[model samples]
Target: MIKITGEHHFAIDRTLFVFALDSEAGKVFNEKNKLVTGIGKVNAAMELTQEIQRNRPELIVNLGSAGSRSFGKGEVVCCTKFIQRDMDVRGLGFEKYETPLSGIPPVLEYGLLKEGLPQGICGTGDSFEMNHAETDYNIVDMEAYPLALIAMKKNIPFLCLKYISDDAGSEAAEDWAVQVHLASEAFNKILF
Candidate 1:
């Protein structure tokens, strides 16, 4: 269910825009359809589920800051695939990223792709990635995997847009602190 469309054709009213923090989305969006779902996967899933129970949104859109090594700072990327970076079950005779008994694959490969944006395979986990080692995903974040799964289970449209706030390995914390606030400037151009 991946499709790409330009911002001019996007319907903001029917979309529920989600963020990990208010600071990430506060500058551009209002309270109408915005949801700030704390940080981790549990919080993201829980909050999004609660909101869905309250009112069914036509689309679930996740907009947040992410760390990337390949992409430059201030770049807005469209993430169509999500993987649980922390799910290590190799000790249990399962694959490294595979969930122990879950039917879902390691990567959740369904999302709405926005036009004119570079695509990314996002790795979602609880910890902020300072220097990510070997991994299949190019983008690192804390919430997108669960959000994409929830949207998939509910059969709602989902879109994930990430602003590159820091270089994953290179002085990430300091760079993220200075760059996270500027995320909205990049997102506003594409999403507003």
Candidate 2:
């Protein structure tokens, strides 16, 4: 178990783990951290909500593999901002990535950064990105936005660390399969 003391010297008691796949979760699996994994955005959101309601951990950490056009494979990054890339409502007069009628801002910020890890904005969606989008986001994942949004809504501290598994190219799936263990190992280094 990792113990992180806050500004007030209060140690975080528990941290919830949210991952999109078993391969990613297996790499960082431990008996101490409570883990919940699902395939896509909806499943991840639902599972995370349920987990938070049931466990109510002091912090929520979403760790997993991501495809990045800006970073090299196996590079780990800490995400301080999250945006939903598939939420396009431009025709309805809202911004392309805006969440319609949601009082919360479309962009969610999780402001925790480790000293040596690169910081980035994670773009989340249901589909795996094969072509790069014309956005400023540096990393792409399937579940970070929903996980971050739920953590924000629940008033829980959120942190996301992503390992670049692929470049969002045609080989993304295969690359992710092979590189997930590496990401997990890297995450282990950060946690301990």
* Cα lDDT listed for each candidate: 0.87, 0.79
Show model 1 residue runs off by greater than 4 Å.
1-10
Give the per-residue lDDT digits (tens) of candidate 1, residues 5-123: 73424456778889999989856787448899999999999999999999888888899999998889999999989889999989879877788888888777988878889999999
Alpha-carbon lDDT of model 2: 0.79
Model 2 segments beyond 4 Å from truth? 1-13
In TM-score terms, candidate 2 sits at 0.90
How many steric clashes between backbone atoms does each model show? Answer: 0, 0
Q: In TM-score terms, which candidate is top?
A: 1
Candidate 2 colliding pairs: none
Give the Å shift of residue 131 in candidate 1. 1.5
